[model samples]
Target: MWSVPVLPFKQLISSALFCALSGLAQAGSDLRADDSRLKSLETTDAGRDWEAVGRLDRLGEGFCTGALIAPDLVLTAAHCLYDRDTLEQIDATSIEFLAGWRNGRASAYRSVKRAVLHPSYVYDGTLSATRVRNDIALLQLQRPIRNTTVTPFETDVRPRKGARVGVVSYAQDRSEAPSLQEVCTVMARQDGVLVMSCDVDFGSSGAPVFSFEGERPRIVSVVSAKARVEGNPVSLGASLADELALLEAQLTGTHVGSQLPHGVSRVQVGEPRRRDMGAKFISN
Candidate 1:
């Protein structure tokens, strides 16, 4: 029951197409000169009705995207897991995370309790541009989100070279319905990782990646990749607090920010996501 379509981001844009390919993959001059504190993107409509904690499944039938960051996690990509060498498990008992989701209804459907896939995913099928190098994944909810736009996971600001990113998914089809556009910018940043101009297609893959701590919008990056810069397609990514400092050193303490690594159990988030986040929210 998540409905909120207003449309009009250049009519869902398909013209900017990654800013008409003004460039591509170029950052390594030794790298590491981009620090932070440049700010200048303040978004309105309360961060655009801000509420995207992702999930919706289907793929072979339809849909695929994700968000949510701790308070029950939810940060998708690792090829959305599942096809793990055919271990298959997509519709894990009705998964959902539609915070502010459109055309589908869920303004807050929170369920999902699994979906890991990032120990170096190998789906033996084809989505492996080199395991997409830990294309990132996580969706652990059983319930813990206090909400306020469910935004966590910052990876502590890194990606630079223009900085001023944006992107809040629910893409569906570039127009005619399903609102939410999110003005973008960043443009480039390789090593620290970034290539924005925010605007994606087809469910807008694991979309997240906002920038505005001065205004209070978190999430550092996601949206795996969707090339065509020269031919006109966009979206490609990495940099969620700079890969959460290597996933907080392999999720030590589980918060990727610290506090879980004691007995290492406490994972259980909800009970539907299907990759396993159930059993261990504090059981050891």
Candidate 2:
């Protein structure tokens, strides 16, 4: 996570509720809003399913959903590649990507060939994600995935006001489950960002938000942040297409870092810890 965490948007809502509902028990449970759902591999491609996206380090071991973005690129949250407390980079060698994981099957397990976090991700402490700022990462697999079940590489076109979109990811809190569901709508686009009614919780960070641009699904943004008032997930456009073109020319986007406050890193954190408790964020 940057000076900010990729996930403080919902934390604010949780915090607000933690303070206000400390006394009401179940009566106060719904005081705050929540993320709708993240899409899942199984739901999108029934022929194939996610095994598990695993990474290990001196810090510990964890998992997340890994979706194919390109022949060699996998998209996930930037925080998954860095340390939350230290703001230090994680050893890529210690990282592993597991796909098609389920019922004791490797489905797909590959080492991270390379990882590229969003350059503009802000580390500042501000967490207004109605239109998210920081929440994206790209990982290249050692070997290209070749299977029909695998989702194809795609990114969103400029969103329309009521375009249909949803999320899919392996969320936390469900130790032995990966339920991918569709329940989000593109609410608006402000400042070149896409807003959605999609709900997100821990483990939902970096999940791809899809919109039907034409015949195929186009990814518009990634799950970046959330809100207490709107009860929807804020997604930021993934600048990979334009960013990669820029990086090739020796450049990066200035939106995130340029707008961030001091004392923050360029990386943004979005995925949640294994222990967090919420309505299994972003179905899928």
Per-model TM-score versus the true fold: 0.28, 0.63
- Global lDDT of each candidate: 0.48, 0.47
Residue 18, candidate 1: C-alpha displacement in angstroms: 15
Mark the regions of model 2 whose C-alpha exceeds 4 Å error after superposition: 1-6, 10-60, 128-131, 175-177, 230-241, 247-284
Poorest lDDT segment (10 consecutive residues) of candidate 1: 275-284
Question: Which candidate leads the pack in TM-score?
Answer: 2
> Which parts of model 1 are misplaced by more than 4 Å?
1-23, 27-73, 87-140, 145-161, 164-185, 188-208, 220-235, 238-284
Deviation in Å, model 2, residue 261 alpha carbon: 37
lDDT by residue (tens digit), candidate 2, 70-179:
54566666565666566677776576665555434445566776676656664334433211334556676778766555555455454554556666554554323345
